[model samples]
Target chain A: MSEQKVDTRLWSSKARNLSPYVPGEQPQHANLCKLNTNENPFPPSPKVGEAIANVLEQQAYDLRLYPAPESDDLRASLAELYNLDINEVFVGNGSDEVLALVFASFFLKERPVLAPDISYSFYPVYAQTFGVELVQIALEDDFSIDPDAYRQPCSGIIIANPNAPTGLLLSLADIRKLASEHSNSVIVIDEAYIDFACIDETNSSTQVSAVSLINEFDNILVTQTFSKSRSLAGLRVGMAFGNASLIEALTRMKNSFNSYPLDKLAQAGATASVLDNDYFEQTRQQVIDLRKSLTTQLTTLGYQVLPSHANFVFARPKDGNASAVAAKLREQGIIVRHFDKPRIQEYLRITVGTQAQHERLIDALTAMQTYSEDSETISNMG
Target chain B: MSEQKVDTRLWSSKARNLSPYVPGEQPQHANLCKLNTNENPFPPSPKVGEAIANVLEQQAYDLRLYPAPESDDLRASLAELYNLDINEVFVGNGSDEVLALVFASFFLKERPVLAPDISYSFYPVYAQTFGVELVQIALEDDFSIDPDAYRQPCSGIIIANPNAPTGLLLSLADIRKLASEHSNSVIVIDEAYIDFACIDETNSSTQVSAVSLINEFDNILVTQTFSKSRSLAGLRVGMAFGNASLIEALTRMKNSFNSYPLDKLAQAGATASVLDNDYFEQTRQQVIDLRKSLTTQLTTLGYQVLPSHANFVFARPKDGNASAVAAKLREQGIIVRHFDKPRIQEYLRITVGTQAQHERLIDALTAMQTYSEDSETISNMG
Candidate 1:
């Protein structure tokens, strides 16, 4: 279909100038190795399907009723899992929605909010949508967030741990420092990929979650999602853990937007998935293991891979033609993400897939490398 | 849990002053006559259940993948059903979300947007959330919208057809006139309850949908939801029909906010429900018949019931104590909506439920009348 030509005269100034975030392609074909979006290459816990089926079987008639606007059951389940009071949690259709609400609730101030330049792209979209000025702090050469950069006076700060496309994890100490230094501003730690990060054995808990800081810092808001770790991307379930007041602000924004954002099936399925910790641990571990292997394999191919803590890895090819390599991979029925943005145009963000899919991707890259060598030899002979 | 005491210091100025929209109660009890929300009494088409189950059984593993960002499948289905191009339809998590996006897309202008003062209270909340200047025009003494009020120069106009809580249908001629006069501004027609309005048999189609006006008016937008006629309140699917330019603006806003607002199962189930027109017609007709009988019964009990064209009947008790009447109904396990807003404070918006539930409600009202008479006699004797 042709692109729609919107009438700028009829459009709001915000809509006319909106540069919407472009999501990764969700190709409908089944034969391709889909590693573009950072979705866990595994099915969710068996309980999720059962829970959804049960809702259909028993409460199908009750679909006529509105779901609990508060999503109390899911929030309670999340609070129980996180060892926090139910008041500390707020759930939404997805983390995107949660983040959008956070922007509206906490970031619309006279001072500009701070974020990493190359973090989750949706941050700027939300900033623009709410008319909040966002000052993006540049990531360091090694793609790590500098806590000192966020020390400046700002309205708020939003940082994605194990930041997307770069996949580098920020230390909890750094997170605490940022939160402490920016005490006046709401510090939102977007932990969307925190589940895939290596467990911090030195910490009291095995998980490297920023939720622990909520008690000490009332300004800290940790947002998470069931999409990556729990393998429920198709089901839009996201949550945030913060102080009661922060959660209350988000709740107000959510209520103002949509009272029942999470439908019955989503609530039921997400709650069941959260309850199955064993299944969650197993799948997350599998993705972590795959990420390691993929990183090693890419390193062997002379790709300078970043230290990845998420389900995806960011790597620049030694020859520095990421867009070309991505196109080549697509021709071979494999998909990987390559952003044509500044400071990262040469990097490809490849999601860690299952063993078989990884092997297929490796074979495709090997074939391309060998063909490149052959072409070079022929050019030398000529 | 106690009410959360939000720290206003930590909240944005918007969130600090935000008065969130309060949805009707969703009580957990199984036996209550839930006539509070205007939800359809019938279950969704059997096909919706089958479709959801099929998605679970077949693509359950694919839950690991993100849903199509644009919900192209559902949009295509809706376009087919409505005889519009796919680009003309925009879907969201719910009509609330759709409306929120619409406000963000088309109403955030320097000039204030106009809305009915006593209509859906959510409009004001959205205006506050988006920081849009909203001028609430007064409805007529009989609670019908005055189209002339919307003719004034404004940024936009958003009116609920067969207006909520009032259940009075504004004629398409009036809607067309509003759109025509406000040609320079975006005119949004919220048709959340339009499906429950009486079918115009004299028209080419039986349903009274303003979607027909979309082709003629580039500035007009019609929004609808599956919650009312399709009996899928718990599914959370809503759509907007407009010119491609308006639809494109909404798409930009939705993408900027959340890529996959409608989850996989929601897309599947809503599509199936839309395709099942026979079941929709049967259930909608049932609601219309039940509403007629309920209006007659309430009128007999000294209530002035408005001539309703929607799923619920708005009526006022002769004594004019709606809060007291609503409390009395709650005591009898019969819940109905009562707004404390100005101009509509005396009315109770009773949803049209099943015949059995209606009988229970009527019986409770009769018992209340009898008790009131007995109490009066006792007071007189004393």
Candidate 2:
């Protein structure tokens, strides 16, 4: 009401102080190479489309009824995929939702929850939203997590494996050590990029999912999403694996928040994608290959590329102006992420796009280098 | 791994004390008359299916990308429908999620929020989830909200118009009074059943929506869902309308919780449903007709039916055994909701179904009455 003069002072104190999570840009330009967000470059499985079409055609009437509250079918598929009991799995709108619930259910304590200072940015936002105290332990100079830093007493712990903006994976042994040490606290291993980190092409046995450690550590929770490897970001499906008691706590949080977080089509499509193992393996392998090629090319160009296990590579430019390089790439219709954080300010996190997109990025960088050399010669003559 | 021995004591104190809201049963049998949850008896518009199919066919690759973080297109559609600015509307996975954010945003004050004693059961669960103190204000003897009672100072207020399980509508004037009285606090009017409460058959002008008061009262936030008259419960889309500042607060809360709460297909389908006014009005009018007929029949069968302004009718059986009657109805493959709570335990909330389903329910009730009389005579003779 313009006449009434709206007042924001009525908002809760937490809302006033809230610094919301800024997700990666979703550029509207169709032709632009979108590498800002770590989305899969390939399309989702054909079975996902078929499953959604089937639901629309046959069960259109049932859209009037609420979806399965617990997303039982989706959970069952995830359980089968991970070789876990159905009760040990929990599904939500996305991995973000699952992680948010974990923070609310397990970490809201008088003591602070421990997390890497430079991990997924959403962790701190969740902590703020839930009124949980968060203690940020800085990553080492090499952008690797120091497990010793997490040994102190805390309410809980969360680590994003193959952490965002760093693209570095933590070893399973290190994760197990942290979980074992935090026996009385809930430890969350956010394995959103674990599928991309699986390097053995000949066998699936090399997949290093924290889900394996669930049975060994009662307090450990592993969260994953379909957005990355499964190529279902638009569908909004994510899952968490843990002991049944921990899963039950997340379930309670979800039910209290929104009874039917997953819609019928999301449940159907996500379940189909999970069952399409061949498609999942093929796309992830393609991304993995591209990451290796891109890393080699960047290294040849005098960039310091981090050893990345995720779909994206975190590298600093030779000139050390990450923001300027990101802007130049944007001018050429290529969008890559550049975080302005303290330690990661000089690095750009680029998603592994298709071969053509990668070539475009290389050409743009080469041209920029040539132009800079020409400009230096002119300045020297003057 | 199995020898580690899990412990439940590690769960946060809040999670341990949580009593999650239980949604209505989604029966697996197709033949049962599901008058338990207040779902529309008709299918959604054919355009909804077409819209979803179009998205799948054209932008299947786009599923690899995250959906619009704010659901701007869907929110724009809702804004157009309500004749309000886009900034005044906020969309979520469902009205439940929207309401949950409202609780976390505006009602988490040090003082206890005020709510009607006999209303949607989820209110208490949300209060507990957000750690907000909630004070229950007793409804009038006729189960209507009294504005005078809400006049007392409190942090915020949430009232369901055409309240659940009671199906009695609160006048817009009363809602305006409460909103005006609580100028410094948010007054939420959940208009989930407003479409069914449009009692004026001659004109649309008589449809009572708190949205009208929004231009006058800055504190009134009206929440509605596509799950009701629009027949999209399975898709899970809901919206809230308020002043820009209040909407901004909700957006902050939503971004902090889950960036993309609405999926791509959900956005497409819900937008199409909002545009299909003919389908929406037809199905709601059909339900309104059936509700009147059902009420008359129930009264003849010795039931005191409440004056309903929703798709469901609330009534107490003359025999004063609502649980037994509900059990009897279930035996006949007819399911209705019966809440065993204070002040309303004797009532049965039956959703208004199609004509054939209503006939089946009436026939079942007649048979039960005859059987009861026969059993009573046999007992007397013995």
* Count of residue pairs whose backbone atoms collide, per candidate: 0, 0
Error in Å for residue A228 of model 1: 0.5
Top-lDDT candidate index: 2
Per residue, candidate 2 scores C-alpha lDDT tens digits across B1-382 of 1314534577888887888899999989969999999999988999999999999999999999899988888888888988999989999999999999999999988878999999899999999999889999999999988899987778899999989879999998788789888899899999999888865644544859999878888889999999988889999999999989999899989989999999999999999998888887777778888888999999999999998988899999997799999999998899999999988889999999999999999999878887789886576578
Candidate 2: where are CA atoms >4 Å away? A1-6, A199-205, A375-382, B1-7, B199-205, B374-382
- Alpha carbon deviation, residue B57, candidate 2 (Å): 0.7
**Global local distance difference test of model 2:** 0.90
Each model's Cα RMSD: 2.8, 3.2
Query: Per-residue alpha-carbon lDDT of model 2 for A127-170, expressed as tens digits?
Result: 99998999999999899998998889999899998788798889
Q: Which whole-number lDDT from 0 to 100 does residue B150 have in model 2?
A: 84
Q: Ten-residue segment with the worst summed lDDT in candidate 2 chain B?
A: B1-10
lDDT string, candidate 1, B193-234, tens digits: 887776452232365678999999999999999989889999
